[model samples]
Target chain A: MIISAALLGVIAVILAWPFPLVLARSDWPARSPDVALVLWQTIALSGGMSMIGSLLLYGLVPFGNALPQSVIFLGDSLRSGTLPADTRFTHVLALGAAILLSTHLLLNLFATFVRAERQRRRHYTLIALLSDPLNGQPGMRVIDHPAPVAYCLPGAGHSATVLSKGLLRLLDADQVRAVIAHERAHLVQQHHLVLLAFKSWHSALPWFPIANRAENAVALLVEMIADDRARRDVDDRTLATAIALVGLGQQPEVLAAASDGESDEPWISSPERALVAPRVYRLMNQALPLSRLATMAVFVTAIALALAPAIVLLRA
Target chain B: MLRMANLGVLERLLMDVLWDSPTPLSANDLKDSLMRPGLATKPTKPLATTTVLTVLSRLETKGFVTRDRSVRPHTYTAVMTRATHTAELMHEVLGQVPDRQAALVRFIGGVTPQEADTLRQLLGVATTDNL
Candidate 1:
């Protein structure tokens, strides 16, 4: 009974925590659209998967004595006649329902991993092209492709950042440098690993709000970090020009390169213009304000606090 | 002159050698110069002329050093000053990140205090007087 209670409690918290976190954290500043999208996707996928898993597990607890301990417990209760036969039937039915739900959830997670792996491999080729020392300066190689595109691949020795030939022709040398610098920052920060973690979490528990929010926040923060690096190394005007130029072009199908897709309608429909405005504003606003820094500190602390209960429970 | 943003660490080292040298260096000359004398260095392999040619070609493409085909043995000359190239590379690196403050905070948090201090100095930030 104690074990069952503990397990149920743990599962309940896992299912419930992510949602509030996501809601609270969304309002905080983010780095880029790429990170935000990935985060939301991960959370949605993970929470949905877990919910399905739970339902499946509930459905599979009937028919034969498949679950040995549960059956034995039922049998002992039956011999004693302490509980009615109808009650036992109801208990078994409930268990079966849970099993069925859990199975579906686990299967969904498995499918997501397979899909992500496929996507990662496809993007890796572009990353390899960028990292290749053919021309030097571990920069991207923009292949001549018609549609605007960008993609990244994490490599063993060095990563690559591949861009489309169209993008290269679109911007001047200074802008191009800014773009390369941005990609390099991603590599240095190992942002891909963070995305991978959040993605897996999302797959495992598709209904969790916190998972979605955390993933989104991290993604945005990393992009912001990379952008900051670009600001310091390159002239703000040049970097802004690069962002404007790249953002103006249609986003490529490839996910490795940074792009502002054409159909990038902001999340809010009524104030849709704010999305494009923020991108432009961010580019124009080069100065780092103290208020922003304070806000970030508060945000980080909140995340840590939100994650604390789970950490404690796990440790206990 | 090669853009610092485009050069790899090894390529940079090789360029440094050529930049400091008074005369043009053949492939053999470069290989000999690269053989570190005092340190526990790896056994030097005889570098092929093709390898040197490839590196030179890459350097040329990045616009760091220019080739002077005027002589019988093609010679290379530095197009940009070393200081300018370093500055450019630094600029390129920083330009890639979207949020410099957040990235700096994360980066500094990840490193040792001493290393963080060094980075702060490198970035020309005002440092505290404490050790």
Candidate 2:
């Protein structure tokens, strides 16, 4: 039990720090955001697993030889209102931390979900009241605004692609089609759910470097993935032009904040400002995608990483 | 699905009529104007008074409409002009809302001028008529 606990501790440390730092610095994610997204999910799953698993195992060592026996014995100890003589203060401390960290993560996830659902409902009410269906466009609604907005309010069966009147006036018909395709990709793929997961992690662990880095990286990757989907329908130039125009009228307030290189403003805003550049560049000068063998290797690694903690814990 | 969709259309149409008027409109008055001559020519059937009332009540509960209980049959009015309401809503919906905790997935980012310049150079500076 102690051996596996120490092993999981090492795994947790590597995943939490050096591994994510190296991954974030790599440019390979730009080549294949889909595979990168899978890798990210595996890392998050395994990291959280090993973190809590190690602590729990270390704390439960005095109870039994394996996880099942330890868990059963711990319940028995609670009923009898006593601990084993081998249990020390360190074991109790580790157990408390493990329980608190798990609860914090889970409660944050639920809170994020509830808050997002409430906000989505409020947004939908306004949209329904203020927006009109675009002429001859089935799933698209046009709002009466001049800031060239485009987005999707994803829902179970009533997802909508909302465009601003300003967007239509700014771009030609081809550009408009490309913009719609991009938003549709977001809705159809449900990118917001992916974001919600990372958002919860970032919110729960605001001080953790990996949490912040993962959220930002995943945000950019999802945008790139959507851009790729839009590219399939329109030529690269058309998609690039559409992106440049739509981003043109976003937030005039951020214009000054973005130009300044050093600011303590939220990290999200700055990276988001620069997000357009890489996406447009990728569209214009398309990089060769990762080859088949490379993609297979990444998938295998992700699968193994995802299953690792389970294999460790389930062993007799 | 169909019922909810119909209610959405009706809500938008009713809000449009109320926003156009200078004074509060009664439920019957709203139904009449909605079925007014120009729109009556369309193939879609006119909404009933009960359906329009139900929608107005829903909008009221959502805080988009104000009910004038002082009048008989209780006239309704849009909470604000469409322009003002749209501007405020757009600011938040686009994540320029103060406090910046947006859950929506915005399609594009705010681009820097330098980045814009780079994209122009790469895309041949095809500034359309709008710019």
Candidate number of the best DockQ: 2
Assess the local accuracy of residue A106 in candidate 2 as a C-alpha lDDT between 0 and 100: 95
The 10 consecutive residues of candidate 2 chain B with the worst lDDT sum are B94-103
| Model 1: docking quality category | incorrect
The list of candidate 1 runs beyond 4 A from truth reads A1-27, A31-114, A122-134, A146-148, A197-221, A251-277, A286-316, B1-131
Off by over 4 Å in 2: A251-273, B40-48, B98-102, B112-114, B123-131
Q: How far is candidate 2 from the true structure (C-alpha RMSD, Å)?
A: 4.7
lDDT of 2 at A77: 100
lDDT of 1 by residue, B1-131 (tens): 43443334346556767777777776556666767565232224545566667777776786666887887677777675554443332222222222121111111111223333333343232113212
Question: On residues A103-181, what C-alpha lDDT tens digit does candidate 2 reach at each position?
Answer: 9999999998888888877777787778877985776889976668788888776678889887898788988888888
